[model samples]
Target: MAFPKELYNAKFVEYIESLKILYLVDDKFKVICDDYCSSKMKTEKYKKKFEKYFQHKLEFENLSKELEDEILIYLIRKG
Candidate 1:
């Protein structure tokens, strides 16, 4: 199933916004995530210029249904 357009768009922006800011480039800003999302370009292409910001490497966490108590409930109710 495809993601809902509104929610998908929001999730996309939110995901990028969560990236750690490495530095500001003139009027533009730079950031890096745990991994690349796609070939599409969002932030101005300072990809190479920006280095990884976080010191702690990512540890995998398998998401579970029971753990999503409130917020997921809220979204489900909202939907």
Candidate 2:
């Protein structure tokens, strides 16, 4: 699957080259990105069952936001 590095904002795709370099050299950053993508996927999955999975969707959305913040911080600092 393609990386979901560009899912958050335009800056991610704009800095694609820098992101590629960081992904190759930073283990923690890679983990954060992967977790962000996973949380996003889970959120989408739960979204289909809005009533039944409301809590699950909300949890994943929060997790996704946190992970996205970490990713942005790393990109700003090291990308």
> Each prediction's TM-score against the native?
0.15, 0.49
lDDT of 2 by residue, 1-79 (tens): 3556435557577877777667678889888778877887888777777866887888999999999999999999997
Error of 1 at 66 (Å): 7.9
lDDT of each: 0.38, 0.77
What candidate 1 gets wrong by more than 4 Å, as runs, is: 1-67
Give the number of the best model, judged by lDDT. 2
